[model samples]
Target chain A: SQQGEEDPQALSIQEGENATMNCSYKTSINNLQWYRQNSGRGLVHLILIRSNEREKHSGRLRVTLDTSKKSSSLLITASRAADTASYFCATDETGGAQKLVFGQGTRLTINP
Target chain B: NAGVTQTPKFRVLKTGQSMTLLCAQDMNHEYMYWYRQDPGMGLRLIHYSVGEGTTAKGEVPDGYNVSRLKKQNFLLGLESAAPSQTSVYFCASRRPGTGRFYNEQFFGPGTRLTVL
Candidate 1:
C-alpha cells in the first residue's frame, strides 16, 4: 500500500496567489520531502522536513510537519506560471528498506 | 557533476522481449532505488539496493529484477516484457545518515518504456 496520500488531487490558482497542498501518511516516518515535476520531466527536490522539525522554509516554499497527525503541508507563496507542475510528497519510513514512498501527487496549475 | 543518469531515455519493446535500464550516480551514494510512474498511480518502488551486491524487493516488484554491482550504478532488468510493464522508470540514489538533511535522493531524468 502507498504510505503517503496527498489531498486535493488537482488545484489551479492565479500566478500571484498562494497554493497549499497537504499530505498524510499511515506510518511513522523519519522525514517528509516535497518534489516538483514539470510535464515530461524528472522530479526536482523542493524541501524536506524531518519528524523532529515542525517547520522549514526555502525561499517562497514553506513546509510544516505534524507527527501527531502524521501529516505535512507545503505552501507556495506568490505562485508563478512556471510553478505549474505536479507536486509530490515522499516519506522515508522508519526502519524500512532505506526507500521512500511517494504520494499520488497534487497537480497545480498557475494561470498567468 | 552529473548527479544521476539513466540510459536509454526512450524505448519501445514487444512482449517477451528483454531489456535493461541503467542508473549511474557520481555522488557515491550507497542506497539506490528504482521506481515506475504511472498516471494516477504516482511512483511505485520496484526494487532497491542498500549497497553494492545487495538487492531488495519493494511494493511492486513482480516483473522486475535489480542489481548493484558497483556503488555508482544500479541496474534494473526485465527478463520478459509485458504490456502491463510499460511506464516511466526512475532511478534515485541517496546517502544515508546525513546530519541536518537526510534521505535526500538524486534522481535520473527517467526512461519512458512502452511494451506493445
Candidate 2:
C-alpha cells in the first residue's frame, strides 16, 4: 500500500514560474522527504521537513509539513528547464525501522 | 567518491533465466536498499539490509532475494526472471544516525532490466 500520494500527476509550466507539488500521507511520519529524478537517472534528495517543523528552505526549494493534515508540499521557485523531472514525496513511519514509503510522484515539465 | 554504484546498468533476460544485480557504496553506510519502479507506480522496496549479513523483506519482496555480506556491498538476485519483473531497479544507502529523520538515502544510477 502506498503511504504517500502526490497530487497533480503531471504539470507543465513556463520558465520562471513557481511550481508546487503536494503530497498526502496516511500514517504519522518522522519526516517527509522530496526527491527529484531525471530521465533515466537516479533520484536525488531535495529537501526534508521534519514532523515537528512546519517549513524548511534550501536554496530555491521550500518544503512545508502539516502533520495534522498528514500532508506536505514542495515549492520550487523560478522553475527552469533544468527543473524538469519527476518529483516524489517519501515518508518514514515513526518506529518503522527507517524504511521509506514513496509516492507515485508528479512529473513536472518546464517549457522554455 | 562514487557515493553509490550499481553494476550492469542494463540487462536483458529470458523467462526463467537467473541473474544477479550488484550494488556497492563507498560511504561506509550501514543501511542499503533495493527498489523497483514500474510505469505508473512509484518505486517499491524489494528488500533492504540494515547491516552486514542482515536482510529484510520490504513492500514488494516477492520474486527477489537480497544479500548484504559486506558492509559496502549488497546483492539482489532473481532466481527465475518473469516478464512482469522487467523494470528499473535502484539501490540506495544511508548511514545510521542518532535521530530517525537525520539520514537521507543516496541513490545509484538505476539498472534497466527487461525480461522477454
Candidate lDDT values, in order: 0.92, 0.93
In model 2, where do residues sit more than 4 Å from their true spots? Answer: none
- The positional error of residue A100 in candidate 2, measured at the CA in angstroms, is 0.4
| Model 2 complex DockQ against the native | 0.67
Tens-digit lDDT track for model 2 on A39-98?
999999998778899999999999999999999999999999999999999998887865
**CAPRI docking class of candidate 1:** medium
User: What lDDT tens digits, residue by residue, belong to model 1 across residues B17-73?
Assistant: 999999999998898999999999999999998899999999999989888999999
Residue pairs with backbone overlap in model 2 = none
Please give the lDDT score at residue A24 for candidate 1.
97
The all-Cα superposition gives candidate 2 an RMSD in Å to the true structure of 0.9
Pairs that collide in candidate 1 are none
Supply the global lDDT for candidate 2. 0.93
RMSD of every prediction: 1.4, 0.9
